[model samples]
Target chain A: MAEKTLSEVNERIRDGSVRVVTAEEMPSIVDELGPAGAVREVDVVTTGTFGAMCSSGLFLNLGHSDPPIKIGRAWLNKVEAYGGVAAVDLFLGATQPSIDRGIEYGGAHVMEDLVSGKAIEVEAEGVGTDCYPQLGLETTLRLEDFNQATMVNPRNAYQRYNAATNSSQRTIHTYMGTLLPRMGNVHYSGAGVLNPISNDPSFQYIGMGVRIFLAGSQGYIIGSGTQHNPQAGFATLMVTGDLKQMDRRFLRAATFTRYGSSLYLGIGVPIPILNERLALSTAVRDRDIEVPVVDYGVPRRDRPSMAKVNYEQLKSGMVRIGRQEVATSSLSSLLMAREVAATLKGSIEKGEFVLTQPVAPLSLAGSARPMKQTKEFPYVEDVMSREVVSVTEDISVAEAAQAIIKSKFDHLPVVNSAGVLCGIITTWDISKAVADGTISQVSQIMTRNVFSTTPDQPIELAARTLDTHSISALPVVDQDGRVIGMLSSNHLSRLFAGRRPR
Target chain B: MKLLLRVAPGIVRKPLIASVILETGALVNIERASIDAVSGEIVLDVSQEKCRQVKDALERLGVDVILLEIPVIRDDSECVHCGACVAICPTGTFHFEDWRVVGEPGRCVQCGACVTACPHRALRLVLK
Candidate 1:
């Protein structure tokens, strides 16, 4: 019997304490020899999902070696348990609900490592990856267990020498999977593409101190930072570039190697009371660290006590770090440049970057195109008279009544010769005049001493006036009391409705 | 940290062998893909080394399993567009492409998503 038959019989004996039957035996059992032709019924599948309640509060200025972000005991657990750069895979089940979460902003340069036609490639050995976007900056990265070893970029043909044949040949092909999270800003992309259709006109310019959030299910982030080469089994570290300019400032460069690579990771947040920020970089290698490089380095990177690498000195010539210049010979100056770049992009990364280039300040979205609103109060002007018609004091009852009927005007303004408005003749006034008949003119029946406003008066105040008087119109005039235009109840409603973009 | 893939008990492990039970009264329901419900009996097949591993893994993940002793049929053709194979496979591992079918073993819950996705009786899930 097949090995499968043996296992099936073992389970059968365990479950029913009966003799094992073979495929041939299934015939007699099904044809009436055994209990066979029976109805089978099953139920729906209940998929299981586990949820996590993660909380963390990190406070520190990352560059400061003197201090680090304040992570309380309770919050520390979050960093150790719930936090850390992680890869997320979402399986869209047949039935799922909508979710929106904040973005997970990360360092720039991610696209350089992505599978774009733009990624630069070269050939190397032992398999490693490095990127120094800027020229004279020094930066380091600390990562925990990645999905793979080495940082091989697929563009480089992976050729390992065959010892037996003594010749080099390609080994494997690479594939990319979803190893990083994705977010859509609607206005700016990591690639720095600005789409102008999604902004508010009132504040066409994105202002500073804007608290940015992303779209997705809670805990899902958008800033992308992971890349994997399945063909070579290597995962590349990605960085962020100005989504508008496509430039990276904070991180100068990165290097990935096999074996128990270098380690030292920290998060920084600023603190006002302490007048200092903190940095906590963990290390994988037991290397000696100097407390300060002030004598050799100054300016922005100068700190009384810092755990930093001197790229300028190192790059000037191979510096000796315990008889081993080779160990750290390849350090680049990009890290230092990255620090400067980060400072410049603080506003951009925070979504505070001005969309327009200047002169004609533009918005990231096109909704903010400039337009003009009426400046005159009795804005409702009669084309024939070249005169204002509103709700204040101006034309006589006979003239106003005649104007209303002739112009088919729903609103007539009362104003002074200086063009300032006093009151308005509305539909109600006309109704009363027609009802009283004894008036014979508009002033005799028109409502007087009604709500009026000046040119500088806020439109919101005009709305309140209409609401308070329970009136449908208000006449706007100048300081000289000259009739301007009529603020209609319908127009005010339309403005408020148009304020929100669909 | 080590991640031990745990299989569930109520889920099916042997979607490949469901074809052997074609004449049975029970029909493989496509929508009920997550759960493994057998009409009369469950059938399955796996290499000796992977048998217990696959079974235990599926069990830990909370998937159901059925044992069978039937052979599999592999005909690059004649596998009519049968939904039978898709119904049998709990894991939607098999994707119908323009040229032919592609199987991602790593993604295969081994529960058989494609088994039930098929419409014809071209495939089988034997115990061999």
Candidate 2:
């Protein structure tokens, strides 16, 4: 009987066949060719899967797939962009490429700015429970940066929560990753000028990625996950099925894959291939009854630590119900798998490969040419903060008025010798005092022990504070009672009116 | 099916990233064709310099490092006195004694080399 491989199934793929072929010696493809193709042969070898995921870095096995990107061009692009065309506009009055892209992809989607050659990343913080595990990550895919040694970045990254052996009572974290956008690139050293893609200065290249985890055991299989890259959508696929209780060594795997751009027919290194369905089904059925560990490539000793325990024994133990419940729950498993599949399909449709999009266009999409949106937002610093001014009791009204004008504010903090933000003196305060002819040293007319809000209080709350106090300006203070910025009543008006401050 | 625990090897590769940090090693193209045989022995062929990296990784996991080398030799002079084998000896085991990068089977693991290096077709690996 012939053994069935993933590629064999790919041959029978009816629209959704994800190709899993061992493509070593796949021709070194160089997108920006000069002399020697900027890449070499790409090889995909398997090591026994599973790392204990020690400290700092997350580890995993990407059984047999890899991402392709040349390194030299990536390096060159990074260097060239340093003070290139974009730098001039960024310094002068040119609308940057990123500004245009920001408008195109909208604040919700982050594309790469060709001028900068870096993708903007969005942190997925408070989405939901299901969205927590696979926090969204995203970047632009510059296929043109392909290298000769077709780079194969295995889909291997997991957080430190892969519970394995004692996972039932204690979780063995089989997968974990602490960082996102782990990049890989290939630098070709070939001296010959070959393809006419780009100049030779582009010697280095770049590719970006994220982390994921998959697990099975305890009578539950998880092909279910909830995450999607916002711009270039993506989703995880898992398989759960019951195997016949036979007594032979076997293999069972449910593969979820994405078919890449046009694939070459010829295989790598001596080209050998083979597959079959019924034979595979039989092979899967006759496996020994030992439970399989969900491999997420965590480092050794750190992964889900396994202990010797038979499924039959677990069933006998009075943990939950009898052996009947231990078998399987058709409805729950089916519903989870369906939901996961639906998410995957939706992501593919929406291009949410990593779940979130950048607030700007800072990726390799090259759409970052000088334009309106790519320019740094003139109002971001202001929106993220308040403009503040301060004054002192010893200063005369004339001095306070001068301080407000010098600080480019209508108000200044009126502090005493203690430097405490006692009261706020705005242009109006000084003007009124001056007009009433009762104005002396600022202390004589200044308000006392006036209330102030923390810098982080929402604009709406600050507005409410101003309206309640009938004040035109509110002093923004820090925890130590230090005045940081001024939340002018005018600023609140702008916010409430939905005006993006210039 | 009987479950087997295959520890994924930890491969660390350093790049020129502000004093490169240790990362998963370079991924070799693992062919699924290895399953086509009943032979369970793992074959690793890399430069002697790289062999240390692989050896160190496996040894950390407590794997007994059993290496194979040529187990036979004729007259040390019949060594073809040629340097073909020297070019490929990962361990740099071959060196010039008398204008000859001659190799002795005693220093050789079962890895057949002097056998193939003999352009005169005098050498052959005596596989045990």
Candidate 3:
């Protein structure tokens, strides 16, 4: 059987004679007609994936203001956007957290809000210059107000990804979702056989300048993604497209609670059935793709791998690990993937969508390296909570209790008139005072022999002391023994939980 | 029908499940029980007709009864069948059958633990 040429496929698509099928549909078609016959009959195979792509962001020229400020610092709805581009140009990263609300609101939210026709507050600051004299400006702007807006993502469409599970005794929060303790849940991210790059494993027709269905609009592949590693079992691509043509339905802003904000990208790639090889690759199924089941409980990227399981076993919902059969779940949305493929198929059948040849093929070589550790040791002053809420020794028992409750602190540092660390009062002490009806001053019930830490001391020492003494918080004092800040177990846990060993 | 009962610390010594079975004459399958000297919780499957009688009897015994509904498996076509829900479920409501995830609705406690544990957001708890 002769393979179809790219031009022939395009002509067939234009004339509404080409048969279009999705990656999900190709398997049965191949089974029915065999490889050679299927390659001869099918003209295109559409693939897609809807997963969190953190390396995604939008570049927009906010037009020009009345005074025309060269935005050195910019923010959209309190989420900081990169202002280092041109005078009015800004790049809002998908994972950039909201300044006020942290991970809950971010650049992805801003993009979704803009696409939904919601007006967003655009605040920018810059040094006044001769050409652009405005120092600061605050105004609401919509997506329509932008001179040019495009989604320029450094990475999207991962070919495949590992399944994550926790082996440790404690639950871990990750971008992959929450992993319960002792192999509680395994979370995998990828549409497997339906993924675009997975369907085109060798990057045959997928290259720079290839037309793609991006967020419901016609888009193109830009280049290899930031960490493109074809040798590492999967391919990654960098893509770009006009943001104006995109819809709010295809763009969603998601907050992974403690893990932070991410953008759910809907990308569809159409492959021209150019050859028998290409047709066979597109017929790949979940049973054929394999990924490692990695333990996220280990704090490093080189975490222990319990087993390498295929998507069939993963989709089967259970895999054997040693003597136990562990459950699995996927983070990628197969529903969206199928929808994209179906939509692409409909467009091709209607002779509305056309395929594009690559301007340049992606590089097949290159590897990504892990981040190196720093040599510097951090100090207590660097990590301590500077916004100290201390109670004076003269405050009444009721007042002390109220302060502890309002601040949500189990222990409150007691200070004196001379700006010195006097003592520390705890909730237990306040409860004791309330029980005895000794509603006098905090100094009467406060613990005087308080162990304090110094600003210049290593943070590890303070943490060790807190753990060793079973204390909740420690007051950080300066050289003059003046209370400067407070360090708590909660603060330390948050810092160390996600941190790699230096 | 299955129900999860939270026995208060004061009624920890009482045979709440036994009393309910006797009062309702309902056949009970204690799928899982985590009772201690202080307090306890149990997941029990009983006859559908006698479920109400069993619930009332447990309530009279000072036990907080929660009717368990089978968690609807959302979008099974999209399910990869990884058993993350099995690891977190206190009751063996989710298990592997020929490497596929099979939901035992009769044994489900409706704890909602599996719903949150499902990475695909497939399982959802609904009232019976």
Off by over 4 Å in 3: A31-34, A373-502, B1-128
TM-score of chain A of 3: 0.77
Question: Which residues of candidate 2, in runs, are more than 4 Å off?
Answer: A1-387, A496-502, B1-128
- Cα lDDT tens digits, model 2, A76-151, are 1111111121111101111111233321122111111211233333111122233223222223323122111011
- Residue lDDT tens for model 3, A1-502: 5577788988998898989999988988888888888888889999988777888999999888888789999999999999999899999999999899888788888988888889999889986789999999998888899988899999899888988888976676788777878887787888888889888878898899999999888999998888788888767889998888887656777666467888887899999888878888999999889999998876655889998988888777678877778877666666677777888889899999988889888888746777676867667777777777788898898998888887746888998887789899998998898898846889799999898888877778788678767998999888777888888887777677865222
* Stretches > 4 Å off in candidate 1: A1-399, A417-419, A437-476, A486-502, B1-128
Better of 1 and 3 by DockQ: 3
1 or 3, greater by TM-score: 3
Residue B116 lDDT in candidate 1 = 29
| lDDT (Cα, tens digit) per residue for candidate 3, span B5-110 | 7888998998777777777888998876888999997878888888898888888888888877744445573344545466566667767664366787766656
Q: Chain A: TM-score in each candidate? A: 0.23, 0.24, 0.77
Candidate lDDT (C-alpha), each: 0.27, 0.29, 0.81
Q: How well does candidate 2 score on lDDT at residue A352? A: 29
Error of 1 at A467 (Å): 8.9
By DockQ thresholds, what CAPRI class is model 3?
incorrect
